[model samples]
Target: MTDTSTSSVPESTADATAAEPEATTAEETADGGTERPAADNKDLFRESEIAADYVEGLLDILDYDGDIDELTQGGRPVVEVVGARLQSLVGQRGATLEALQELTRLAVFRQTGTPSRLLLDVGGYRASRRKELAAVAKNAAEKVKQYGEAIKLDPMSAFERKCVHDVINALSGVESESEGVEPSRRIVVRPAS
Candidate 1:
């Protein structure tokens, strides 16, 4: 029901923005010199704007009521939809939400002619899932430490595996690795040698 744009640069952040052209430009340097665009670093706000518009249209089509907020986090564009009765958009284990995120990224790519790594969250699914995954990672790490043996976890989505890997990497006496192919990819936590 509401759309928020991150396109406008607040006057307060103007100085920081001027000092960091990489945050906006595709390739060109701050001094207008030549440089290949940072493939992982593009115009974050613009990406958010494009993704927000796309999600807003989707909401309208589904007759859904939600407040959409778009912004950049950790150098990646993020779109969050907040509203009651939005569980269906999240689907089972966020399958639908993941599909919708890819579609939104495609929409951004079509407009900007660049691939987008935009992340979409419906009803705080990702945030909650991250917490849950963190717990899972910690528990697995504990098991590996206690048993002093390698432990293979169930297959997980890329996002889930990434979350687990991040958490496991931070723990001592444990390391993690991914094996298998798509849809069957999983993480293995083992005691450090």
Candidate 2:
């Protein structure tokens, strides 16, 4: 799966769910799953703890403080930092946040020796932007169905394009593909092959 750092596919696995801090240590199951002290999944929370520690170090270096909440949602580690004046952390359509999330995940990978599915949110920007992009994707799908002409969205980050691709693919009459290169890459919706 593409690393859409600011995104969630919205299926909360039974193996993992959301939670706040104040955790109890856990051990691995015979099936290689981590058992949670709480009803929530421990593996995801474990990943989030690792991620939060990494982010907290960066925060200390930058002298920034916010509420860091680590939870496992959608079978992934989600770390949310919420506070004032952090929109710059999001960059233009969250490009900077995505890069930071990648870097942070790399930090986790170094520690665990396995790639992580970490979702980093600073501010509530991603939720808001996702709604806006869903609308855009819906509109584009309607256009594709109506005219049968190819429609290309403006250059978007990889995450944004993935959101668009999912929306278009779910519709009946059209399909989507990413074309071009980073910083100028985009999505194209067309008749299904």
Candidate 3:
């Protein structure tokens, strides 16, 4: 397993982790909107390193060969695994991937004592899924606009729902909202009033 760092390494992961909690405290801004200090790049990079190490260990135990990339993207730690014959890690509808991501986040939290917003992607599944979800959102929006009625989408994961919501929000004439609970949560698109 190879680890790649996209940002400058901190003097110590421990030092970065220790300073994270204080930076996360919410404070009122001039406009009355609550704001929190942006996570330091070093801290975020350390999170990616931790997550990558955890994932590397799992791959070793499973005897899988893959290249792991660790980096920070959009203010969150991201780990991407790219290789052949890794479909099992991705699982059906990315269920296993999501589970693994949560496990990786837990590993980071155990060491840092702070929750991590870590994104783990296997075999480019998320990128392709995002495109598919965008098409689904556009189709649903079209149906709602034409029929002047609501269109209910199938149950989806939070990531999938967010993708759909993004597309719906970018388009006109339709609005979207999520309803139901986990494992059954879905998005509904309706003609904007």
Indicate whether candidate 1 or candidate 3 has the larger lDDT.
Answer: 3
Residue 121 of model 2, lDDT score: 85
Ten-residue region with minimum lDDT total, candidate 3 = 10-19
Q: Each model's TM-score, in the order given?
A: 0.78, 0.73, 0.80
Backbone collisions counted per model: 0, 0, 0
- Best candidate, lDDT: 3
Model 2 lDDT per residue over 67-162, tens place: 899988766788999987677777765656876787888888888786676778889777786677788888777777777777766655444555
Write down the lDDT of every candidate, Cα atoms only. 0.68, 0.64, 0.72
Q: Which should have the higher TM-score, number 1 or number 3?
A: 3
Q: Which pairs clash inside model 2?
A: none
lDDT of 3 at 1: 7
- Find the candidate with the highest TM-score and give its number: 3
What local lDDT score does residue 160 receive in model 1, on the 0 to 100 scale? Answer: 64
